[model samples]
Target: ELKVEQNPLFLSMQEGKNYTIYCNYSTTSDRLYWYRQDPGKSLESLFVLLSNGAVKQEGRLMASLDTKARLSTLHITAAVHDLSATYFCAVDKSYGQNFVFGPGTRLSVLP
Candidate 1:
C-alpha cells in the first residue's frame, strides 16, 4: 500500500522568514504534486514534479521531488501574509494518474 505523509501539520511563521515542509511516501513513485488552499476554498495546484529532481517554483513557493528517496519538499521563501495557506503534497499511484495525498500543512504568516 502507498501512503503519503507530511511533517509539521501546522506551522507558524514570521513574515520574511523561510521554511520547508516535507513530504514522504512509503512507495515508489515518479510523480508528485503540491497544492495550496485558503480557508473555505478548494485546493489549487502549485506544482507537478514529473520525475526525479523535477522542481517547480511560483512566487514564494518552490516544490521538488526525489524519487530515489521517495520524498518531496515544499519550500517557502520570504514568506508573506498572502502566502498563508494550507499546503498538501501527493504522490501518484502506481497505476494510471491517481494520487494519494498527505494530510496537510496549515501555515500562518505573522506580520
Candidate 2:
C-alpha cells in the first residue's frame, strides 16, 4: 500500500513571509501533482512534476519533485493573504491507477 504524508498539517504565517510544505510518499512514482483548495471551494491544479528533478513555478509558488527520494516540495515565496488555502500533493503510480493524496496542508496567511 502506498502512503503519503505532509508536514505541518496546519500553518499560519504572516504576509510577506516564506515557507515550504513537504510531501513524502512510500512508493516510487515519477508523476506528482500539486493542488490548492480554498475553504468550501473546489481543488485547483497548481503544478505537475512529471519526472525526477522536475520543478514548476507560477507567481510566488514553486513545486519540485525528486523521484528517487519519493519526495515533493511546495515552496511559497513572499506569501500573501490571497495565498491562504489548503494545499495537496498527489502521487500517481501509473497511468490508470488512482492518485494517492497527502493529507492537505491548510495554510492561513495573515495580513
Candidate 3:
C-alpha cells in the first residue's frame, strides 16, 4: 500500500517570510500534484510534477518533485495573507491508479 505524509502539518509565519512544505511517499511514484484549499472552498490545483526533477512555479509558490527519493516539495517565497490555506500533495503509484494524498498542511500567514 502507498502512504503519504507531510511534515509540520500546521505552520504559522509572517508575511514576506519563506517556508517549505514537504511531502514524502512510502512507495515510488513518478507523478505528483499540489493543491490548495481555502476554508469552505474547493481545492485549487497548484502544480503538476510529471517526472523526476520537474519543477513548477506560480507567483510566490514553487513545487518540485524528486522521484528517486519519492519526495516532493512546495516552497513558498514571500508569503502573504492571501496565500494562507491548506495545501495537499498527492501521488499515484502509476498511471490510471488512484492517487494517495498526504495529510494537508494548514498554513497561516500573519500580517
Cα lDDT, all candidates:
0.93, 0.93, 0.94
lDDT of 1 at 55: 88
**In candidate 3, what are the lDDT values of residues 73-108, reduced to their tens digit?**
999999999999999999977687578889999999
lDDT of 2 at 94: 69
Tens-digit lDDT track of model 1 for 1-111: 999999999999999999999999999899998989999999999999999999888888889999999989999999999999999998889758899999999999999
Q: Candidate 2 local accuracy as lDDT?
A: 0.93
**Per-candidate clashes, comma-separated:** 0, 0, 0
Off by over 4 Å in 2: none
Model 2: per-residue Cα lDDT over 9-96, one tens digit each: 9999999999999999998789999999999999999998898999999999999999999999999999999999999999896656
Query: Candidate 2 at 77: error in angstroms?
Result: 0.2
| Global fold similarity of model 1 (TM-score) | 0.97
Model 1: residues with Cα > 4 Å off, grouped in runs: none
Residue pairs that clash (backbone atoms under 3 angstroms), model 1:
none
